[model samples]
Target: MALLPSTRAITSSAQALDLIPIVNSITSLLQALNPRNPNPKNLSSSPLNRFSPFLDPNLVTIVITKQTNPFHALFFFNWASNPNPNPKNYTHSLRCYEAITNLLLHHSLFYPAINLLKKSQKLSDFFIGKIIKAYGDEGNIKAAIFWFNQAKAIEKDKYLYSFNSILGVLVKANTIDLLRTLFDNVVKEGGFQPDVSSYTILIRGLCKKGMIESAQKVFDEMPCKPNSFTFNTLINGFCKKGDMESARGKVDEAKTVMSEMWLNGVKANAATHLNILKGLCIAGRSAEAIEYFRWMASCNMDLDAKSYIVVVNEYCKLRKIDEAVSLLNGMCGRGISLNVISFNSLFRTLVELNELHRAILLLLQMPQIGCSPNYVSYCTVVCSLCRTEGRMREAGYLVDDMLRNGIGLDATMYGCLLEGYSEAGNEEMAMQVFKEMIGKSYVIGLESFSVFVKMLCSKGMIVKAENFFEDICRTFPAVERDGYRKILDEHQQITQGSIKEHQGEESS
Candidate 1:
């Protein structure tokens, strides 16, 4: 943040403090005044008498705003509320009242602030708004609303402060249900008219709740002109709007809102509609998003990788994998690249749906679209194929692809390779992968190691199985070597007993 001039100081000249020297003089007098008699009865003895000539609303504002101490501010405020001897009959303006009220609230002196505000008959909507927000800071929603309703019942002001304060608190508290109720009541009352702020706050709350259509509805029927803040809020709502159940009318409705905003002198930019496309995607309305993007293109708006990626992610979630594949191919054609993360989502989805071939094609074509395959991009396909019965060869080919792409196999991938080859009954390939896994100091998991050991023992390669187990125990100290060795010894003993029994039967 920029270093700014003091809030209490005048900006007119180079003066960094209150321009009136008497403000400081009065402040000093106030701080040093009698604690026994807050208002000193002896005027001649009081230094404030010398500075009393300078007491005015403006001077009082300067002094109070500068005070870091709320009590000092209150003292100055009381003195300015009515100066003794009554030369000027100085009165507190709404600004003076605001300064002192804010100062008291800033100090967390809530009770005193309320007392001063009520005693001075200065508890208007603005002051009430501060108190409401103070209660909101305490998470005391009931108190905040009580003050709001109390102010509303007594005062006839349309909502300048209290509404914004209470509504903002409600929005933060996720109490939009109640906020909507109050808004409807205020509008239905007919006597008090809500201003731009009231509409803005409610629309923001609605947007946050993903009630896009409702927020849009509010935007459409706003009685007053929407300001930049309101327009910005509406556009943001369009980005996250969840109610995309509108078959096709939402885009046109958005266009109408934009056109109206343009007519109202809030110029609509073409780039802003990109957010609406995101909204369309978030609602899983892919068809509408495509239409919206096409409309954006017709407006000659330049869309980027992020623009296509948003739709791509949403499309991946749909059952129509073919459309997602088509969109990805089109993105490649446009020279727009997807990151491996995006392709990974597609890969996992396709592989899960038993579309391994399609996933492999996308993986191979990732480079054509300028995305280098990551560990996850290859692992998703390779791991799925390893689990399939007849797809072990395809898994091997993907491992080669992974190596060629400079992506090394971690323990998970290595374990998958070992388990796949072993379960397929390929002794030579299983040995090769085990060697590579060991060379990388990556220990195969106990499950896959068991598969490898059982495969070797079944093929009468018991010595090789024992050597592999020892190698694994050497590298991975956490392996249950003693228990596994006992199992291996039992296998050997069982094989010997069967052979001896068979020989004895032949002799008989």
Candidate 2:
């Protein structure tokens, strides 16, 4: 018998199996397995069970005949590929692995499915390249580099494709040193010419890292002159670095080059406009940021989440709380969803303005907008509440709420609550919170202990304050010890001045 059957015979056999009908029938059968079936007994007696033999191991040959739907074919291929003691079936495992990888790559489920195969210790440089590409999609260059190294170590033969994938990842990650080392290796050992894509990735990464000078040098040295993307990346880099003069010059250069080349119809994209706006914001030119925002609106360019965030932060930084709030509300009115960074910025501004009520309301509104309060949001609100007069109870409630929602309370949050109780003249409650912090093995910082000691001394608990001060002095660094000593000196000065004032009054 031939090692492989002819295509005609395989096609005739597949048609005889009527794969489409079989898939439909299987799908229906799986659907009927639900728990809400009205007549359970009828399902129990259905004819689907008679076809249960179709799922049997001995029926592998028959299952292969019915391979059609990619998912269903994968299911059968997996069944055929199971490790069997029989030596004759070893080739089936290779076919099954190839089939599964192809199906997953086609559907873009490359990373997860490749991970599943890796557990079986069966992957080659080809499979590793696919995995690296998937990691690149997720912007996870570290994981891509790790897998690339693994592939190189195991593959006996040096594959240039593997080097290219890793180099691209490193460039995307802005790992300039790694990129240079790999580039040298590629040239020395892999003997592959660097492509335009490779050079572009490095230039873009350098630009993103604010190494504009190096990026420009790379651009100048490119054997194949630069393209528009290369220019755009450089311009965006300069804008990000707040070198607007250079950014604008690059833009003008691009236009000049395009005109000279007679390459019309190519212009800046949304990112180009957004970068300019961001640069203006970072340079504290809020008026310019707003002007560019309006320009973007007039040009009908879709404003992104970051565009709104930049304007909101700029307004907040200038202490224009009302304007920031108005912008946030306007963004919602325009259906521009706020992400975590935007919400955190707004929350911090509210905290700084001592608008605890509004900050609390914002925290409550996060989940409604499909945003959850992260650690930063929780910490901001907690710190604000701690600073509020007569709001120790509310601060306590928020801490408990954070814990209940599985947001692990950190040492700083615990310290804030302790300080809140102490400031509110509830020393006992403060002690309780301190005990909780100690139980969690959190190293209490010097500033925190200093606050506690001052609170204790104010309440005429000098001995306890001295003991706590001693503990802090022992644990803290030299710089922190000096800070604690300053607090202690201030406390002593206040005490002595009070005694002198009392004596003078008595003598009078």
Best by lDDT: 1
lDDT of 1 by residue, 373-488 (tens): 89999999999998889899899998898898788889898888888888899999999989988889886766777778778877878889889878878887887777767766
The TM-score values for the models, in the order shown, are: 0.48, 0.60
What local distance difference test score does each model get?
Answer: 0.76, 0.66
Please report how far candidate 1 places residue 364 from its true position, in Å. Answer: 36
lDDT of 2 at 464: 70
Question: Where in model 2 is the C-alpha error above 4 Å?
Answer: 1-163, 169-194, 208-232, 242-269, 353-361, 364-370, 388-408, 462-508
Which ten residues in a row are the worst by lDDT in model 2?
A: 1-10
RMSD of each candidate relative to the true structure:
12.0, 10.8
Task: Look at candidate 1 and tell me the lDDT of residue 220.
Answer: 78
Stretches of model 1 off by over 4 angstroms after superposition: 1-47, 84-86, 156-160, 241-256, 268-508
Per-residue error for 215 in candidate 2, Å, reads 3.6
